[model samples]
Target: MQKGSFIGIDFGTTNTSVVRVFNDEHGYKTVNLGEGGDYPFSSIVAIPRQNGGSLKFGRDIKNHREELSSDYEIFTSMKSFLGTNKEFKVGDHRYSATEITTLFLKYIKDYISRTHPDVDLSKAGLSFPVDFSPEARRELRTAAENAGIKVNSFLSESTAAYFANRKAGQAFSKVMVLDWGGGTFDISILELKKNSITETAVFGERVGGDDIDFALAKRVHAEIIKKSEVYNPVAFEDMNLASKDYLISWCEKAKIEISNTEDDYESAIYNYGMYGTKSITVSVNLFNGVVEPIIKSRIRKAVDAALGRANLKPASIDAIVIVGGSSNLASYEEAITNIFKDSQVILPDKPQWSTAEGAALMQIIGGNFKLNNSLGLYLSDGSIFPILKEGEHGVGSVIETLSFSLTEDTQDAHFNFANEDGVMFERATIPTKGYLNEIIRLSARIDDDQIARIQLYNNSMGDLQHSKPTNVEVNKLTFYYDISGLK
Candidate 1:
């Protein structure tokens, strides 16, 4: 651990990991914090029942699971609701998703500070999903800042994973990153060149490992009730909150066990309090059956959609890189291999930590910034005039000037900002009077900050080349960028 080095924080839905990358004589190196036992700890927080009791996080919540729904108010998957209006009510305090996330991150910062006293946690690169909205990115950044951490930049999880793999000597011309974590499934089609990596297409869904865990838990609960010897066994839905939460936890563990075991069947036994003890045999076939409708179908469609958006076919992909915790499942490998039979499928070492490691690597290598969505204008004929096409420019000023004549007398010139997909997300207006054939110059540029700045110059008022801008409007569209030089 060195001072002034940038750390990478993969603040995930179900788990969070942090890695510090710094340059030495040998080159870039990374050291995993929270080492020994809990390197990639659980993404969970629990509020104590008592007023003075300290809030619990990560392995603390796991070690005290039975007391969660009863003794403490538990919050998980806070990242999924980053930009939403979701709130958690605990006692007289209501916590927003951002607030809860801040608490969790502060805990992480403190934990690292205590473990590695000499390391600087001031600046770090954070990883987010490609499909995360601008609002979500803003909220995530705010949370980190609130937690005493300065965000250096944001990197997409898929891109981070690619960087990690590439550093490990896994190279490909065009690659698809299948990132199936605990809370989301993201597919990214990227074009890799010697100096840069371009994201061609990205698709994501909220469904993930948590969904599968719940589905499997319900299935197992049904089986348990059927074989119960009690006079009147309660259904899984009717069960108490603690019981249901405990069952879900058990099911998650069982799912992992089933995936890791080589035996034909793995037995999971649990006690449902008054409902008596029950045991169910789980096999690969049974696990697949429970998750087929939930996991397999969705990923296939998402992958296809990503490919279609990129205007690429299955054969066009040179390799498929699998990253994230849930990607370790055998079913995920089978499903991906089945679809991209001709493409090479690679599962990197320690797939769960790949994203965080990649984020750390990005801080070292530097990256280019690109627009995630197109910025353009709407024409009078219901068509779009692209001012700055998405993914065309990076990290500099791009100016586009177009001249248009007024068809008739108009007091105001309306500019509707649209994307290449024909969706108008914003509009701007310039107040100027002009008659027929009077030319107006519209100047548009995406600055280094990714803000679309548009200005209008009315030739009728003064010299067309020397006149000042009549009006300027800024459209806060979404833009994606990676970390720049850190040395």
Candidate 2:
């Protein structure tokens, strides 16, 4: 690595930011590169000419969203679509998912190289969702390599934010990092003492800023139908279809407006050439009333699941730090404030930048701040296992079928047969036997796009007052067989 400062690139769902750790005449500081010296929208490669010749990347892409859509190429929010089977098309040309991401990453690399010609591009740390599958991480690594940067490590988004917050001078023993980003929402409960971070538990849902946008867009459709004077449903549909770009753009703005306002709202609606449009103001109460419960349900469930996994009481949490674009919503902030009435909810400045900034902070802290001894598992015997016993170090055996959400279905997901907690099982190949009275921790690769979820001891604890239901989507499912006794 070069002696010069390194860069922290937070390639987010809605935006991307690049932060450099540099020392000037005054001292050390982290400077954000791009618009107004702050985070830049994570958009790149927009086609400008209706015929498609040159493409616009980054901030420039957003500036020319309209014209570029006509002739040039526009690839915005490509991050959220990663790992999906979707492809980007400009004119008649189609690109594979990873190729699209590469072009964007290359733009960032070129920007950095232009700004700091002498800095080393090798050994860069990339950030991914904590629950990202091994396959997804590999794709990201490949993307960075294609961008001409040698990736040294890939850390979870919340893990990066945890260290970033610590570097910014916040300290806690049991800190809950609630990172709601542009594309994903992850809540990580860390048993932090002094400067070290021990991840006690982690839970995440695919719901995020994109979901919020979708929700708001639905609301806008309803509002327009209710208020449009020329409201011919078929006509309106045709217009919107013809000018899909305009409706989407407007929906983006409406989402922002709802995020900023708390009262009934009104705005002149612009009509796309195909979608005949007019203006309408939505009652503040109407928008909030409809979306509030949905938002609360998701956030509460995710946060509670992580807390429940850690087996910690509400009072045990010392601080709750909300990170990500969705976390900035006043409704979310108010909800957290209401839950942890006594504990403060810390929201970082330029909230979206925290994860990438945190990743850089991890560079300074090294291996000490990570999850140690945390194991994932699957059952080998045709017996039910318990989740965890009261005060038990690990999940205890229960009498029910175990549900495992495997990400890639890889070898790392297997466990050596064990029935006891003290005996550490050695790594073995497939067709392994399960043991009785033995405890094993297993982690697996379930699929190409999703993270692996192993079924540990099942906990049939009765409903606790603070227990929140989590909504997770699993792409692959498997069962646990307790072959512990057989082995």
- How many pairs of residues collide in each model? 0, 65
- RMSD list, candidates in order: 5.8, 11.5
Instruction: Tally clashes: model 1.
Output: 0
lDDT of each: 0.75, 0.57
| TM-scores, one per candidate | 0.82, 0.73
TM-score, cand. 1: 0.82
lDDT of each residue in 1-487, candidate 1, tens digit only = 2334668888888888898877754557677776335468789899876688788898878767875667688888899999898888888788999999999999888888888897788768888876676567778889999999987766778777877776432367788998889888877787766556667777777778888888888888887877777788777788887778888887787777777774445455555766666667766777788877765568888888888878899999989999987888887788889888998888887788888877777656544667766777788988887777777754455576789777667877777777777756667665556577778888777542234567777767654544567544443344444433322
Q: State which candidate has the highest TM-score.
A: 1
TM-score of 2: 0.73
lDDT per residue, candidate 2, 289-370, as tens digits? 6557766888778777777767786678888888887776677787887877767567787777777766554444332221
lDDT leader: 1
Off by over 4 Å in 2: 1-4, 23-28, 48-52, 115-123, 167-170, 229-245, 257-266, 273-275, 368-371, 374-487
Error in Å for residue 48 of model 2: 6.3
